[model samples]
Target chain A: MAIEKVEYWRWTESNWKNPDIPDWHGSLITAGVDIGSTSTQAVILADGVPYAYSNMRTGSNSPDSAISAINWAMKDTGLTLEDITYTIGTGYGRVNVPFSNKTVTEITCHAKGANYIYGPTVRTILDMGGQDCKAIHCDEKGTVTSFMMNDKCAAGTGRGMEVIANLLAVSVEDIGELSFKVDEEPAPVSSTCVIFAKSEATKLMRSGWTKEKVLAAYCHAMALRVVRLLERNGMELDFAITGGIAKNVGVTRRIENIMGIKALTPTMDTQIAGALGAALIAKELVEKKRAKEG
Target chain B: MIANYGYEDGSGHYYIKIDTSKCAECTAKGCISACPEKLFATELDDFDDEVVLIKEDARNTLQTNCARCKANGEKEPCRQACESDAISFSW
Candidate 1:
């Protein structure tokens, strides 16, 4: 089913329900946690509106990382962990979340978060994370219809950027910012594998290619691969790109040029879409319980 | 202490030896799932219908550089995930 086109607020501090608005849950709150390969994130929602968020470097164990993230977020709001009505977990490590009352797939969580932020009209999501890259297709109600995921490769994920960051002696955050300064796009990278791509980038640098050009090419190649993934999944307009890569403006701009659609990225660009979706699910579960008790 | 040996060929010779045996215990076949190149494949032999090793060349695949799959040479995920303890890392 095609989603209805509509304009959405990237961030508005909860239009759904807020403390100033009637029917706001002043005390009722829910939480969501996402445990990814490199980082873990948590989000707290009050009456279906985001109130607090936290992200941190993940520990060796996924469960430990998830728990710590939640704890950190709760502390930010000065709320005890037990004050959370329901907790939901989503990501590759969702099943390992001991505090979670339910576990959902990252696919569903991403779709839900994208829909909530960008409206249900979003048909595609290009999510480039630490260890996985995915292009997902969703229906009107934010249900995932189909998806293409690359979990075993680092070519199109943030890990690729990290490798390049190391080669350039710069932080990963600087790669995209530096890419924006390029005067001319460099030669396209030949290999999609991380090792080969790094070698190709090194060779380009040795060939007198400017760092700007090389970095731009890296962003270009990533966008190219994501575009191909979208095409493979059957591209539909009104697309939104989330995950860690969305924070990279250089890559996001190139992807927009290739796909020919403005990709929506929320202000909380690094705020873990999967965690937001889990919190939304948890909110729904809490509301159902309240209704049942009434 | 267990001896930790590595190969320059990037073929994951150690992972393969451990995974083949661990899969006999776990239902998800993690070694198969975790291997990017899928170097370790399971198939029936040509001469007989019995299963045999179907080695795949992973040189060109993405698994060549995944150093974290084995992760610091401690208890391997494929080995720890194994319920039967059929797999072992040996020099």
Candidate 2:
């Protein structure tokens, strides 16, 4: 069957507001904007607590995407750009956030965000983003101790999965479930490159291979690719995954099984880890300024 | 034969340039072990010589993966290890 021209991997945008946040009428408000290659996230914090957040697809302009994300986050909260005491930008477009007071690397931000969501015990973080993957080791306070990243290749990232979804005409969200329906776990694709894998998948399809089997092969390859990165950095306990791929059960399950350890479940949307961490940093910066002034 | 690794994105341009001529003369491939992120490997180039090159998976992420060294004002480990002065970063 010929695949239709559709963005099968485009996930829905979402926004959330923490109900427990007390009124921030006079309190410090901070925001973090993470403009990733494929998505943008904005997180608002009121006195260092998560107040509101928005996740959306990134558009052509990095600065514009950052602004749009933050605006969407602030929409229902009755907050505006002027209300923010500080702003920190992170992710691939950290330097492009025009309004940010500071910019933090996504590594540091992801560590801090994982600490907040998974608790301070999280020592290992694997963030599988749209175009890259990162294996980060952090201290109890979420300060990065060591880290490695894979961005030159697209084989083991969310983009890789999207390629497969487009090829198979399957929804990206359903690829995980469909991959498990195969009678047996197929051997992973031979190539570690996404381009080669796509060609290989095409050959398999032409040879009468089922879509489920092809998906299983691709997912397994992605899991193994990430496992190599994690092992190179020396995996520690209290591991967590923070990124779009964290929602993929197929890849996550295989990673857990291969490592013989379970990842800590995130309490919030995984994609917001970097932005949330940036917001937390913004709060700290604001408090530091206040103390200096006082 | 210069090899450039990295990509241009909305944020900025990040590239790691390797002078293959300098690399061709080097007998010891120290860069492969010098990088903590294991971003380097040896490959046979068109000249049929074993030269050190940045791994394909690390090209686009040079700035991020090298943050520690960059922030500390320390020379990049790979560049420091290359006695031939073959590796240079464009951040």
Candidate 3:
């Protein structure tokens, strides 16, 4: 009997709505949609306050992904499209959010979002998105001073880890905890390229290395790769990590260990940073418009 | 705003940062035609000012796409053609 294939790399999609905020009737409802390479997020804000959000895998097309993401965010929230006063689209497909009132770069959005999530003290932000990694320096107001991103290859990004997760047949959510099971830290993978690293990992596994040891090695390599980006961009104190990879203890712990700096623990879901920043921008635009009209 | 187009990776950084403020005053905009791959273009930026920028499709592939220019041992055509001194590169 043949067993069905299990796609362990796929993470569960999540949608959340704050129960405390009863209704958005009197508030200005603003929305933000981030269409990233591997995932999409929709965030809704009521009068510049956090509200509902959804995180889902991006489909082949972005417009559909944007719409579905928002729909999922509004599910059971008693919210409707008509309730939103404005929407800002951001990320890899910022231009393709069919209903966005405006578009902003992911770099700008992520910095602003981190400022809000981690508070005004946050100065450095490391965002490990699906296909890219960003190291950003921001001011107290969340304005970007300088930023660098690694998008040419998948070496240290979420996509790279996804490849490893599939190779190990381990659930993406469990990759972090499982990686720490090893008794001693293994040396990092020497190959800098994702494809080459995958092959190197396979070789190690074949040579009697356990899956956990390979994972530890890969995570160490990822941390080093991302640290190089931070060093290039200049890291400041009160550093924070965002995006999906921020949830992975394997990578985050390794990075903290190497840098000797503790990243801010997030109070909210880290994946929503871009969308939240977009929503924040939407609120600013609406305020500007209202002030101009008055 | 300075528009940085390109990415960094394990291999190294490859970027072309262009100052949009300077581009607004430029008339020739030679970077458009200077690149052998025609990687540069112009568009109304977020501030509604027409400025030069790298093509969206070429942003992520700058490493391989710009290899020939860097390997040729000549100043990059895009930066060399900029009369406004607005363009710079990270190799």
Find the candidate with the highest TM-score and give its number. 3
Interface root-mean-square deviation, each candidate = 16.5, 12.4, 2.8
lDDT of 2: 0.85
Model 3 chain A, poorest ten-residue lDDT window?
A18-27
Clashing pairs in 1: none
Model 1, residue A111: what's the lDDT?
Answer: 82
Inter-residue clash pairs, candidate 2: none
Worst 10 residues of 2 chain B by lDDT: B1-10
RMSD of each: 13.3, 10.5, 2.4
Q: What's the C-alpha lDDT at position A242 in model 3?
A: 98
Every model's DockQ: 0.03, 0.08, 0.39
lDDT of 2 by residue, A183-232 (tens): 99999984368898999999999999999999999999899988977886
Candidate 1 regions exceeding 4 Å error are A1-27, A265-267, A292-294, B1-91
- For model 1 chain B, the run of ten residues with the poorest summed lDDT: B1-10
Docking class of 2: incorrect
On a 0 to 1 TM-score scale, where does candidate 3 land against the true structure? Answer: 0.91
Query: Which scores greater on DockQ, model 1 or model 3?
Result: 3
lDDT of 1 by residue, A123-210 (tens): 8888788877777777877776656665545877877877877787666766778897867776567425778889999999998988
